[model samples]
Target: GSWHPETGGLHEAFGDITAILTMISQMDQCEAIICHSKGDLHAKTYFSAVAEEFGYALYGRTQGLRNADNDLTMSQVTEEVHDISQVFTGAFYDILADIFEDYCCPEKYDAAETLFRIGKHITSLLLQALLKGPSSNATFSDIAKLMISLEPKKKWKDMIRRQFSVRGVVGKGAKKVKAPVDLVWGGCHCS
Candidate 1:
């Protein structure tokens, strides 16, 4: 489906997200290094046990993130799914961050344990959102809207919307999809 822009990107994104969720499901939940170190703090994020490479576009020399934090608006995007996919991926990351921050270590909410639980919960939410949220030819905003509707508790609603908003994915004043669109040749188109 990479052959087409209207639908291919979402399918590719669905596969990528599903794969990440599946991997996390199989992984043994470890106490975040922060929790294990007593008080040695680290940047709050999904700490991959191995070198992770989901967002190839997100990687950089110093910090590796292809706007998965959802800082890039749709108006700023091109036609490439990998680049565009970061908007959703960033939302997912921020959701994880929100959960991590909200459930900070308490007597009841241990930091390490909360990290484990967040993985499980987010995996389910991501699956549900992928299956039930986005439409076939969905724009980023459409997926965002569908996801917002399916949230039973409005969990991270404001954050998700705000992320999508500035990126031009959705909100009161989203503009049109413009181009010189970016494209990935992926062998088929290379010849």
Candidate 2:
């Protein structure tokens, strides 16, 4: 549950502190809680003070996480963020490792890791394109062509009917296809 301040400055902070304090008083009865913020000292201090009140022991993990029994501080969260970054960085550095492996006889793991990153990037790009809308110039014909081009050949007849609403085909004084065909075939013998 989130509570917003009706009117006041740091008084809201006091209110938040009070609410958290009340919640932490019963921390033993609860399993865990997740708190999100912009990593400010005010919030960190509030949680630290509340944890201390609850007699929850805070421990620092080698992974850079600071845990207070069932709760985690932003410092601990930062550690997890760092771990993810390391993974991304390793994926990047693997490109150089691949070159060294083929040209300078390095480990095969490097090439495999680099290939994984390349594959991931390709899939992510395609996923993003699908999630986002079509391009500015995408028309009914373009989309129809794309659907037909895909494997298994999806029949989009209904989609075409709904999309293509042909109107204004018979302009002013336009008789019909039969009349035009007759005129073309008879030639200009009378005229």
Candidate 3:
């Protein structure tokens, strides 16, 4: 399920955290498979097959684990899970604050909903990048281009393009200027 802050109380929040951890574990497994196989088509095909067969099995195990925690009572949550949840929440809040600062029309959006959509979009971009190639050295620009290409909305595409533009400080004769260092896209760099 998508991230919705208004959904429930602490119990639901714990469940969502548990689910996110499970998904991360699954992605780690897939990444290992890809790396071990040197990112061949056979590896991708095998992952597809494995995902279809064991996806529900993993989900069941996650649910059972959650259920065993007795609805994620604070006292029942393991120390590790508790720590992870804290870190995740802190990071979410930090990112949300950054987005709010950067957003042009914050008044037009709900903070929680915007954060949720950002989370979903980032997840989608990550998975799409993995599917494109299991390159260990994939850069931010690579993912940004993928996002720009996959995003259907022109406004979002423009926003992404602007976001990815290079910015740096230039100095000459004791003068300093903050400026767009370059606008790099599709292997072309412009300043």
Candidate 4:
């Protein structure tokens, strides 16, 4: 209902993450689980074939409108929901990357299973945060603070803080993205 950078972005992130998670759920194997996103035309393959294409709005059917791997900051945000969403989404994506780094390597300790396990945990935390992470007029910092406050004191706790912190999503030190719409309309729109 309103136009707020912070809420809009967070809403976008929720859509992207949920779509990716759904794609992963349907696939039996997640070989490139850490880095695989083709953004292909095929409903089943786009999630795995196109890597790094996080919903590019240009070139329509060719790429995604956003990229979670993008290194965006407050200054880079364009006040667009998708653009702003990338910042927080990037942090979540990085957490997955970090988990991949930790569990998927020469160590080879059932990397696939570890990836899924960690992926589930990350999704759980994300959902928890979304459900009760922030309050009215929440900003990027609010997300981090809320999640940090609600998050259990476990190994990933610090990592969670660092991920958001690195992306300038945590604490009052970072720039604030404001506003929040009650309804957020986002979809593949993949021509």
RMSD of each: 5.6, 28.0, 20.4, 7.4
Task: Please list the residue runs of candidate 2 whose C-alpha ends up more than 4 Å from where it truly belongs after superposition.
Answer: 1-109, 135-191
- Cα-based lDDT for every prediction: 0.55, 0.26, 0.36, 0.61
Off by over 4 Å in 3: 1-109, 134-136, 167-191
Worst 10 residues of 3 by lDDT: 166-175
TM-score of each: 0.65, 0.16, 0.30, 0.70
Displacement of the residue 170 alpha carbon in candidate 4, Å: 1.3
Superposition TM-score, candidate 2 onto the true structure: 0.16
Output the worst ten-in-a-row residue range by lDDT, candidate 4. 34-43
Distance from true location, Cα of 32 in model 4, Å: 5.0
Our tally of clashes for model 1 stands at 5
Residues 25-131, candidate 2, lDDT per residue (tens digit)?
34331113212212221233333232243333334323123211122211222223332222212221222222222332225443233333333432332234333
The TM-score obtained by model 3 is: 0.30
Off by over 4 Å in 1: 1-6, 15-29, 32-70, 177-191
Better of 3 and 4 by TM-score: 4
Query: Candidate 3 — number of clashing residue pairs?
Result: 0
Candidate 3 Cα lDDT to native: 0.36
The residue-by-residue lDDT of candidate 1 on 37-135, one tens digit each, is: 342223434442112353444453233333334455555656777666665665555566676666567788666666666668777665676677544
Task: Choose the strongest candidate by TM-score.
Answer: 4
